[model samples]
Target: MESQQEIKVIKSSGKRAKFSLTKLRSSLKRCGADDHMIDKIVNSVRDELYQGISTKEIYNRAYAMLKKEKHVYASKYKLKKAIYELGPTGFPFEKFVSTILNYSGYKVVLDQQVEGKCVTHEIDVVATKNEKQILVECKFHSEEGRNCDVKIPLYIHSRFQDILLQSTAEETKPQECWVVTNTRFTKDALQYGSCVGLYLLSWDYPINDGLKDRIDRLGLYPITVLSLLSNREKQFLLSRNVVPCRQLIGDQFYLDHLGVSQERQEKIMTEINLLANL
Candidate 1:
């Protein structure tokens, strides 16, 4: 117990680092868990910590505790993991971003073919607002702890530049290229993206306006975050392009298709309404 302070946890990157109480506490706090609940969860988690434990295990333990307290807290705490649930493919993630941009008042189109200066490129998402057009490239990784490296921005910047050079490109209205991801950006990725003027959004980058910030601010959580839905159920919804919890709120008949019981459906929608009304 005395040596618990020195315990090392394995990250998804296979790197081991000393566990920090501050980091764990901050994450719980972000989920809107108050000091009292935070203290209880933190102490409980600390008591269970052992050397060589993985971060995933720590998160699962904490998430279970949070869920026991409040479904809303647990849902929000699971935001990052829920985003991961968006994909075995990048397409669902792209649709997820398009949905967010749409809620933010942008007209969004997905998987568009645009002619660049040299070759035609398929844009993951093209968002337009008030005559401003933004081309978004989404990078989705199925695994955690994989950060977007400098090479990503470095490579995408060239394609963006080519599109910028297109004389016949549509609208041409103050086009901006954005790179969005569900993970963190490497230091070089951030630097290169900034230096090249490419808009970058990741889990926690850009301080106040990262992907997580945007999601929390908008209360636009993915349906995958719902606690009662099994993985099979979530995948069924995703296959039907039902990504946002708000969207599912309108069309929960998908729940019926899965043969979910009326009682279970009520419980699921209760959780969704809590998030939707957040």
Candidate 2:
């Protein structure tokens, strides 16, 4: 019979080793496992693994271990918990709104809280362009469920009132309200939004196309260009006293005239290139 150490080494080597129960047992032991934990981990790994598992298979095994036993070790449970905590589903709803608005030549302000009668509400993102403010509310849902009918209308009504009050006498009133949801809205919600001139944006709209076209025709390049700027670049611009311009111009003129100073323009291009590489 092979020595335990030799068996351990052979079982744990190569991509093919991932399928071996002997390898899992050895790994659990190496990690300082008690017998009960070793058995549990080995069984879990054995059940989930097949031939040709990669090194990154740890995550898959850890996730499966957590789901199998509700009362699993904290370390195992954390593997799945961390996924939900850091998942795009949690906060990227807001990010998605910002991306679309930035593409469409609008400046985004995030998480602005508004106080209203009988309730206090928060707007996920509010976009300003050419003196026209567009209110955006972002929702992330597991499915296209009933909130489309109930929550969306109530949300629109509340935002409509608050936006009206927030407008200054000189500033142009918000021309439209936007609800950007991860899931598609029901038929009734779409009709309601259309009736009130609320622009509903969804995943179906190509982010680059909508933005580029608007920038081309309306000379809304400032909005489109600023949208492309990184959070750091935007901050740098603000620190230097750059502000959003409302003047109407063609795309080519806006790019040549107002996009940036020669030095700052080079910096912006470098940043965009780096982000593209990433």
Candidate 3:
């Protein structure tokens, strides 16, 4: 049966878009939901649809059904949401980005101050490998539907230029400056970044080499994505600087810190290892 309803739905950005079945299928598939489950969830979700339905509710319903089928799938489905949980502070997000780069074999430094031509600039992450250095700025948003606008890259690039100038004046190799976000970028932001030679990376930019791609490539799912973990427990792990699920690998001691029962730890470990599968 097809839904007879047609309505503009609200997005996390508060923008309205026509409901898309293809989009629903793609997202469910991307999260490892099979055809049968996707149909069930989509049909269930569509039946609940009304004028001005928020995508958040659609996702919640789909996720609830997905989790009911397989908890691991729920973990995979919440990757974007997990990124959001990385902050009200950008510290954990910077570390999260640094950890991702580190897995790709880069040496990373976090929260360092480097001198620019005009003044000192506090860089979020400094990554070096094979004598090439890259300065990364991480912008984290706690809420969904936020984007890195052109003004962001414009501001960061000016500081990068100043730093680059000073580094060049010192007769040393200069660094590349990059702005990274846990969300998407506006069209103007992408244009400004490319036009200025400032590298920009976000949830799904730069073609196949965006933040989400890298995480999937490395199985570096964050601890926040653990479905069974409470928000308090997740925050506790983040406070201790334990970000990636891989970090807790073979270290049952951290589970001890959370007071997880030995039996519960085993189940949690099972979910953690499932994330590493791809």
Best by lDDT: 1
Location of the lowest summed lDDT over 10 successive residues in candidate 3: 167-176
Model 2 segments beyond 4 Å from truth? 1-89, 115-120, 143-147, 165-173, 205-278
lDDT per model vs. reference: 0.90, 0.48, 0.88
Q: After superposition, how far is residue 180 of candidate 1 from its true place, in Å?
A: 0.3
lDDT by residue (tens digit), candidate 3, 9-87:
8999999999998988887887788899989988888788888889899888988998899988899888999999988
Query: Relative to the unseen true structure, what is the C-alpha lDDT of residue 262 in candidate 3, on a scale of 0 to 100?
Result: 86
Q: Which stretches of candidate 1 lie over 4 Å from their true place?
A: 3-5, 168-174
Relative to the true structure, candidate 3 has a C-alpha RMSD (angstroms) of 1.9
Model 3 per-residue lDDT at 273: 87
Ranking by TM-score: 1, 3, 2
For candidate 1, list the clashing residue pairs, or say none.
none
Sequence-dependent TM-score of model 2: 0.40
lDDT tens digits, residues 1-278, model 1? 64777899999899999999999999899888999999999899999888899999999999999989988889989999999989899888999999989999999999999887799989899999999999999999989889899999998899988887884646674379999999989998998888989999998878989988898888889988888889999999999999999887889889999999999999888888888664
Task: Score candidate 3 by lDDT.
Answer: 0.88
Query: What CA RMSD would you report for each candidate?
Result: 1.6, 17.5, 1.9
Off by over 4 Å in 3: 1-5, 169-171
